[model samples]
Target: MSASAPICLERGDIQGGILRAYGKRGYPRARFLLFHVARAEAGRWFLEQLRPRVTPALDWAEGGESVKPGQMTRPEVTLNLAFTFRGLEALGVPLRTLKGFPEAFADGMAQRDAVLGDDVGPNRIRFWDPVWHGEPGRAGVHVLVMLNALIAAPDVMTARLAKVTAEVVGLAGETAGGVMLLEGHRGADPRWQELAALWGPQPDGRMGPLASEHFGFNDAIGDPVFDGQYPDGAERDKCRGQGAVDGCGNWRPLATGEFILGWPDESQEVAGAPMPLDFSRNGTFFAYRKLHQDLASWDVWIESRALMLKEVWGLASLAEARATLKAKMAGRWEDGVPLVKAPTFADWQAARARMAEMTRAEQTAFLTEFGYASDREGRMCPKTAHIRRANTRDALDPLWDAKDGKGRLGSALNNRRRILRRGLPYGGRDDPDGEHGIVLLAYCADLFRQFEFVQQQWMNHGLDFDAGNDGCPIVGAHREGARFVIASSDPAKPPFVAGGLKPFVTTRGGDYFFQPSMTALRMIGQGLVDPT
Candidate 1:
């Protein structure tokens, strides 16, 4: 499909979380429930009861008009459902249809330790939470229930969740061969996983605004924008830095199939989805990852590294060195200022101050609307930086001006590998050693091509970026003798090498799920999924 081609989606049929990140849309509190379908009939019955409550991608205002950003009235509670491969099998999906899914998804996440680098250190499957460990003599994680809410008080949130949860429990009891809710490792409610925004407490005893993660960096910026994600003019405005960009620095929304199923992708072809058009169309794959952040280790590493880096970077204070080191590692400052835009400590400070006065659009443009064509030498931002590796953003683009032999700024290569990031940080920031990290939900059409490829190739290995085996500085599984190199813009200065890196982010557990469309949900609930 041409870049200028208009793409309209069936918003009512698509699930809400695929197109919109609810945490950003006034739903700060969330609860995730995992279930094992002991019997197919009971599972379908449970799904039937939950079908009416499932939220859609379509956004509406008070009077049912299309909503602009930050203008829609938030729902008291928003619900969505996804199912594992085993979940579908338990629900009596045909063998032919089940076999149509990708191999990586069929094998499950725990079984893909080699590809994901989860076999070693703290990320090993044995160390994972018991919820991930399958029920005795049963296929693990048949169904995933996600509930995002807009409650401010913890008590109110719990009360609301309990009421809805009780209804679900009641439905399960109404039929024989009932489903069972899995016990999560964290939270008071063992039956379900409770997740909330990492908001700090206010001086007046109320919760403050959305806060940073345990790593102390602004999170959830630069999420991918695909065709039909936003309405008309809003699409252009929001796609500025969130979408595909060409050599001319012109931005456009990526093809819908890159994130959603059954649409023409960047390749101009609809991928071969699961059997039956109604089942796969408008549906997407989901990767639910629980990452635990080690604050104590991070603090110790930063405190010790900054002292040495202070002299190497020629910075006045250890604090400045620490912040600069972090920015180089992440390719962005703590306040979400890209290092490509603000390379130095002084520049970062100035940028932060300027961001305070600039409009939201201006701030977003400054932070995200940047390319790596000018910084091929990794001078401004290291080629091995976390953001650089995650989104190459024109760095991998070949020379567009063949006559002039000039490397072009484009996101064509990156577009196919893009995955929509959903979910938010889980635990409190105050207790570093506590169960605090991000509940990362990565949604895409192709799990292997998008989610796994990014995890294995970009984040876990740096060969593509020309940094050899060096992984992402922030989240990579830093094996023995792992080090991060920060290149200097000055010809006279040598690159700063920070060593003794360990795994800062460890995978607690995760799984692959299929988030089907509203139409598919109905078919599954009614047990009318006819593969023929």
Candidate 2:
């Protein structure tokens, strides 16, 4: 491992050990505890301080060094912390959940442009507060801290264990933190209700009922299936290959059973895992979608241009729509490879035959490069296409190392950010008026560097800061009239016909969080945060 990467534990090993420990204690199942961080800086500081305080008894591995460089492995501690609205206040920083920030930022940017009105300045900075200034109570910071420890004792023993764990970590008397007991099974313990009541009304009212159901089992099954598949085949293929696709699809009916919990009135069990809670738990990402499900209409607006879908994708013919969609995404009709680089249809099939010869990374790199260069003329890939805007390596190639003696500037922003998109389609076929849409979930190390920067600076705005033009075609949001437009480099050819988006996916809720080491959780429980 390199010097910069942190040591990580295998998630399976940790989970298995936890389950075994819980089983040995006679508990039917294991329960997870969640914590929320208020501030990013505070979280960083707290984790840094608590690293040493974490005990070996809680440590899953022996002699695993603290996070070192070049380690792609999971952390020795398998703990995930979510940042929340209340936690943000503690950090003294503005808190904008994912849902509020993007919309508010888009509105703010539009307003600034409107005020400027044709005299827009050159790359000026604009600040917008989506939560505090736009939506008041609707937006708040929320982070869910997740930890798995063996529940070895009965009610009385478990209470003693909780107190002992708290005291062992010096968390017995701490005002800065809150503790809420989590029961594995409600039927086995009457105190579960009392503990649930103490947490107060859940901020989103989704957690309580979700907890009442089969806590560990629900998570074990629901986390992977809903977050991994349900929408994107590419993601599903990836998860299945990794063996993360457990038996969750079979649990949907049971999800709404009397024991299962959900939102909008608790009468309906949530169709999928609850938001934020299910995010990234199963080594998958959550795709958030603001679907306009019209129960009255059984019709859906899947493809606005059905004719184009028929013409371009050859769907409605013998080809399946899903297969055609995947083929189009690959830039080829069938046999693999891309039409842009292949030109002749025969070459595409040849490329597909050679798929076994190349590594996965090689294929992705090949596609990325081909798409980047081919879109210049907007003949192969439209200049305004989502894929084109995202991977601008060819465009930035000329400016990569060019600098004005200050810092690295004028180059491809591709290396700076990349997103692993995981989205699911919501609203059943019963809904009409185009109720179906994608819940787009993306994961990246830095929101500013990856997602927000791409959306605001490149995709939505059409300027790369370093590279120029309206950003990505597929996902970028723009104002009416003054749409951020892209034109092909080839003047003789027109840009691929692009359409405006209705901000299809809105950020309803989100928070910045850190998935910490298990040792870090112990420190947190012990109140190891420094006074300084």
Candidate 3:
């Protein structure tokens, strides 16, 4: 039951032995690698099937115990299998590209050293890299598989199907990858079925949408237009600014965008040899967002507020009022799209271009130039602007920083904490109540370090390394009438202030998982999950 036991079995002596065996055979090229992890019964069945072809690397003392710590009983069975397309082809087993997890565990141990506190232990720290046998590649293995069922099975037979599939797929030789069983959710569960009915079929075979539609969990934002744009780019601009449009006649938004699969090309030959098995072949990553409609109506809110501001400041035109409001809020516009970048008030294209130029470091510099330093002052990005909070791009403290003496800049925080921000607007643009919002789908490697940390700590709590100031100005939720302030460009000048901006988007449901390689799949299929 000790953590080390599983580590020893999977990554230690047994794994090393197998890798050696495979290496002795000239490290055969793998055509496709199949990965699967099943329950104990499934694992047993798979092992039984592979027993004749592959030798088990079990130790008497470790084989009979549970892999998890503190458990006296053995795992009903643990099945980790990988199948090599090349090996399968050689054996006359025709195999095609199967589904894969985008975020599978590597062979290395848990990230014990990276985490904080004494809660870190053998079980907590990963001793092996999930990709010990391979390299990191872009294959939408995690969310994609969950969004769609990779395998096809009847409602009543899913559990059994997964079990049998695990065994059949396991039984490849060394050089084959291992299978990884994502921890949460069962393929056969009713909840999954309902979700699938609403979504669509998974890439592999199960029925479900490529993405989930339900949004009623923690901090969940409602369904949003995947990549919708309002008619008359001008109207879109107005809406982004005033949160409303009066003159536009055919204003509407689009839904979703083209789907891109992450499969490797099979036709291309490599150095006179066939291509490697496309483990992540035929899978796609669908970005789902929970947008807040009311927040997006900020343009209208600003316009209404502008009328009042005009009365207060004696402004004659709406344009003047809008400028004054921007000054008061310490920024150019509501979308966090600064007017300084697009001073001419160009279209969204101009705004997007400006945004693209502003990298994390550039953004930090720009905000800091306006007298808001992310390193010391949280007011600039509010300690929580999606960019400032997520990973902070090496702005974290030394303890959290990956390198010493270089402060935050020395670390490659970008790699582990990058988020693919696939955001889309939601709700009808015509709705006057400002009910339309944006759905933000962010893909990151580590949820705790990248996503959750930003939400709970920097974005929500305003607690960065320095820990000063409130949460993000645009996104942070606060009490009514509370002033959200940001410093002006002039340090000598007073700060700008905005009030009554409500919380927009919230977190819904999300899970963490690993994406393994196709070669790893073959390891699982062969019941040689133990690489040690």
What is the overall TM-score of model 1 with all chains considered together? 0.94
- Model 2 Cα lDDT, one tens digit per residue, 1-532: 0112222223331112221122222222222232334444444455444444332212232245564332223222223343333443343332322232223222322233322211222121222112212243432323333323322223543464455345323431232443222222112232211111011134376322222111011111111111212122233232221111111211111111111112111122232321232221222121121222232211122244233344543335423443333233323443334445653234445666666577976654344323233244444544444444544434444432333423323232453444434222333333342333322334433344455555555565554423254434233333343222323233553432323333322232223333323432343344442322
Poorest lDDT segment (10 consecutive residues) of candidate 1: 400-409
Candidate 3 runs further than 4 Å off: 1-292, 295-301, 304-417, 423-427, 430-441, 465-469, 477-482, 490-494, 520-528
Q: Rate the local accuracy (lDDT) of all candidates.
A: 0.83, 0.31, 0.32
Write one digit per residue (lDDT tens) for candidate 3, span 304-335.
76676666545567776665454334333334
Q: What's model 2's TM-score? A: 0.43
Q: Write the per-residue lDDT of candidate 1 for residues 426-473, one digit (tens) a residue.
A: 776565447778889998888888888899999989999888888898
Per TM-score, the best of the predicted structures is 1
- For each of the candidates, the C-alpha root-mean-square deviation to the true structure, in angstroms, is 2.8, 17.1, 20.1
Quick one: ranking by TM-score, best first?
1, 2, 3
Best by lDDT: 1
Candidate 2 off by > 4 Å: 1-79, 88-141, 145-350, 353-375, 399-412, 419-441, 464-471, 478-502, 517-519
Q: Which ten residues in a row have the lowest lDDT in candidate 3?
A: 1-10
Q: TM-scores across all candidates?
A: 0.94, 0.43, 0.37
